[model samples]
Structure formats: C-alpha cells, structure tokens
Target chain A: MSAALQDLDARIVRATQGGLPRVPEPYAALAATLGVSEAQLLERFAAMLADRRVRRIGVVPNHYALGYTANGMSVWDVNDAQVDALGRQVGALAFVSHCYRRPRRPPDWPYNLFAMVHARSRDEVEARLGEIRALLGAALRAHDVLYSTRILKKTGLRLS
Target chain B: MDELDRVIINRLQGGFPLCTRPFAAAAAELGTDEATLMARIEALLGDGTLTRFGPLFDAERLGGAFTLCALRVPEADFERVAAQVNAHPEVAHNYERAHEFNMWFVLGTRAPADIARVIAAIEAETGLAVFEFPREAEYFIELRLAA
Candidate 1:
C-alpha cells in the first residue's frame, strides 16, 4: 500500500473504531474530524469496501436484545474432501450467521465445519440444525451444538 | 419496529452512503425525509436493537491477531473461571457454550505472539487447558437479520 493510503486506513480505523457519529451527516462529521473532504473520505471508504478491508458499513444489531437469544455454534464433521462444497451450501442458509472450515483435532475435536445459528429459542435452533443435517446427508459423520450460557465479555475491536 | 423501521433496517443492511448528506441520500431512497430517518436510527440504537452503527474492521488485515479459543470448565468452577478469563483486556468477547469445552471466546491482540501469552495466562489463572481454533479459511461471515 502507498504511504498516503496506509495513513488514511489507519486514521479511518481509529476515528470510526468507536463508532460513526450518530448524526444526520455522520460521514461529514467524521470527515471534518480527520481533516479530509467529505468526498475524499467517502472515496477511501469505497476503496476499502472494494478491497475487503471494511466488511460493511451499517447498523450492527444485538441479536440477544433483538430476541435472537438462542444462538448455537453448530459443528459438523464432514468428509474433508467435500467440506468446501458443503460449507458453501450451509452458509447460503438465511439463519446461518457464520460458516467456516477450521482445522480439526482428532479424538477430542473432530468437527471441522462450523455454522452459527440464532433463533428465539433452543427448540428453534435445533429445528434449524435438523435442516442442516438434511442438507449434509451422508456426508455428515457426527455433529454437535454448543449453546452459549453467558456472555462474559462483549466489545468491538480495540486497536491499541 | 414498524414498517418504516423495517425498511430502514433492510435497506441499511446493504450499506450506508458515503455522500455529504448520507442520511438525506438514504431518506430519499427510502421515501422518507432526512430528519425522520435520523430520528428512527437514533431510536433503534437507543433501544438496543442496533448495537452499533459504523464500519466493521477486519482485525487481521490491520496487522492485528485474533482467534477463537475454548476451555472445558468444570461445572462447579464455571463462574470463577469465567471471571478470571474475563479479566484480561485481550479477550474481546467470551461466551459460555453448552458442551464439555463450554467456555468459548475470541481473543484479539496487537501482535500474533500475544495470543499464546494470553492463553497461557488464562490456563494458569483458571488451571484449564485452552483450545485455540484459528480461522484457516473464511467461507462466509455476514450477520444480517431481517426485521
């Protein structure tokens, strides 16, 4: 990255890490703080979005507060060769918030594919898991759901 | 959330504009005025429906280290262990999952090496082995809930 672009990226991370200003013209307010024109700041934001540096710019709702209290980390032990294809299918599901393929440890941790499902209750989560099971079919060897009991800590990314 | 609120949530999920008057731009698209759009967003945030409104940064891309770690805490020592684990600033978000390896959390650090140090400290503090699952690949990760 160019020095100028790197500097802008750092500034963007710092200025907005806390949050965007809750105002009618939040980007404009932020641009004033960073001593950049509104158009320049927006251009940099668009560039970052295109490059996948910033995932998305919008409201991040609290699932628990929004009645999605029952969240489960659904793990699946699928055929290693078929995981990539199967993972894409699982991730396409609307209820699956996050889906990824991580390394699996033998004997102790055998699940490789992880999908997070959120719902109003555990029963709803279980029902969704059943849908995933049907989707996996013969490829799924074993699976488990880890429902969160408590949130010990919750905070946004702090760059220090 | 009423119809307008739902519209705001659904429309904003795609993204907020980067114009001089972003709210005004969005309001025009949603067929509402800027003041009303701003007011509804403030209300939604104040009510905790929206945890935050801003950019979502990728920690790894910014030379930061993060990983999903889990610990199998004994039934009796769950709360004590959770307290000990939560005391560290490096631990961003920790959750108590219902499984043998019940306690799961994401640890973020300025340097990659700090992750091991934090895990060691937690193990020493709680006397439990910490299982780390660093993301090998990201198939997809987007949290968009329809209202």
Candidate 2:
C-alpha cells in the first residue's frame, strides 16, 4: 500500500468510530469538518473501497425492532482444510449475516466456524441452525450458541 | 459535490424510509425521480457494493438486549459449538478473533436475563466452558467495505 493509502486506511477506521455527520452530503460534510478538500475526501474514500482498506460503508440497522428479536452468535468446529469454503458458504446465508473463522484458542472452547443469525424468536434461529447443520452434514462439528442480554455499544467504529 | 454521488451516499445511510413511494421521497430530497433512485439502489445491492438497504436497529433499545461474549473451545469442537450458537435465533454476529478466547459472538434477546440463560444452555449442551465476557467498556470498530 502507498503511504497515502496507509494514512487513508487509518483515517477510514477512525471515521467508523467517529460520529457520522447527520447531513445529506455526509462524506462531504465529514471532509469539511476534517478540513480536507471534498474531492480529496471522496478520493480517499473511493481508494479505501478499491483497496479493501474498508470492508463496507453502509448503515447498520437495528434488527431487534424490526421483528428480529432473537440475535444469536453460533460457533462451529470444522476442519482446517474446509474452513474457508464453509465460511464463505455460511457467510452467504441471508440469515447468517456475518460468518468467519478464527484460530482455535482452546482448553474449554472448540468452535471454529462462526456465524450470526437473527430471527423473530428463539425457535426461528434454531430452525435456521437445523437447516445449516443438515446442509453441512458431516462437516458440521460440535456447536454452541450464545445469546446476549445487553448491548453496551451498538456503534463504536470511529473515523479518525 | 457531484449530484449523483451525493444522492447515492445520502440515501444509502439510515435506509430508505419505510412507506409507500419511499423512493419518491428520497428522490424528491435528491431533486430526482423515484425510478432513478430505486434503480440505483437496486444496482448497488445486486453488485455487492451495498450490504443492505434496510433498517439498522439498536438491539438494546428494541428490547432484545445483548452483550459481547466468547468461549475457549477445544479445536475439535469449534464447528459444533458454532453451529449450535448460530442455530439460536438470538445470535446476531459471531466472529473469530485473535485471542485466547478465540470464538466471539454477539447475542440479542428479548429479555436481558435470557442472555445468561442462553449461555448456560450452550455450555450445558456442548459441555464446554463459555468464557462470558460481558462488556466492561464499549469498544466500537467501524468496518465498511468501500464501493
């Protein structure tokens, strides 16, 4: 990455956590507030997207109010060889909004394939999992589903 | 600002309002027509450029309370636990991070107490220790895939 891109990367991360401007031209407004030219700001934003410096730029909705009352995070244990393939398949599921695999840190923990699913009720989420499990067949290993009691900070990504 | 891009970004956030003729409202604000606005949004979503054009709800406020939680799963059972967790409707997002408590997932429940109950259930079902890390202090990370 170029030095300018590296700097833009840092700025983009900062922007995610920072307050978003409540205006029509939010990006432009953000640039104005930060004292950068609107064109420079747009270019940087565009560059970040092009280089994958930023994963996505969009509003994250509140699912709870939208009848998606049950929000659960589930982890799966899959073989290392099949992790990426499974992750992409799992991530692509409409109900499974976010899915990825992280290194196994264990003693008591043993999950690898991670996915989040939302629904109107616990039953709904469970049903979705059943479908996923059935789809995975033998590839699907032991699993644990954790539910949340409170959200401390729904929005934390700050833009620098 | 280029009128087109400005309109795109402005309508992209907070979602298009839910109502008949929602696009028209957005277009009016952008000094354009609904047909054009709708077409653009459709294109964006189809191209994987935009994640979703829907409501970004605040889980806590809506009543499905949640917290950040993790577990130290045995490497062998990782897949099982993940499937079990994802099966539950309450799990919002589950992520694998670089830490001892490698498996991280967020839970949203109708009642705050259900969060603990659900964790306990998972532990009992999976026979694994769920290292529950309730938020000590809120940490926010904004990750946006640029288009």
Best by DockQ: 1
Consecutive 10-residue window with the lowest summed lDDT within model 1 chain B: B135-144
Please state how well chain A of candidate 2 matches the true chain A, as a TM-score. Answer: 0.78
Model 2 preserves the real interface contacts to a fraction of: 0.03
Angstrom error at residue A117, model 2: 1.0
The residue-level lDDT of candidate 1 at A4 comes to: 92
Q: What is the C-alpha lDDT profile of model 2 across A18-98, one tens digit per residue?
A: 334434455566667666776776676565555544444444433542357787777778776766776677776767766
**Model 1 over residues B1-147: C-alpha lDDT tens digits?**
899988888778757887778888988999999999889989999998887788887777777899999888899998899899989998999988779988999999988999999999999999988888888767677777878
Model 2 alpha-carbon drift over 4 Å, by segment: A1-26, A105-107, A152-160, B1-147
TM-score of 2: 0.52
DockQ of 2: 0.06
Interface RMSD of 1: 1.7
What are the per-residue Cα lDDT tens digits for candidate 1 across A85-106? Answer: 9999999898998898888877
lDDT of 2 by residue, B27-115 (tens): 78778877787666666555544545533333343235666677776778877877887676667777654454657677777677888
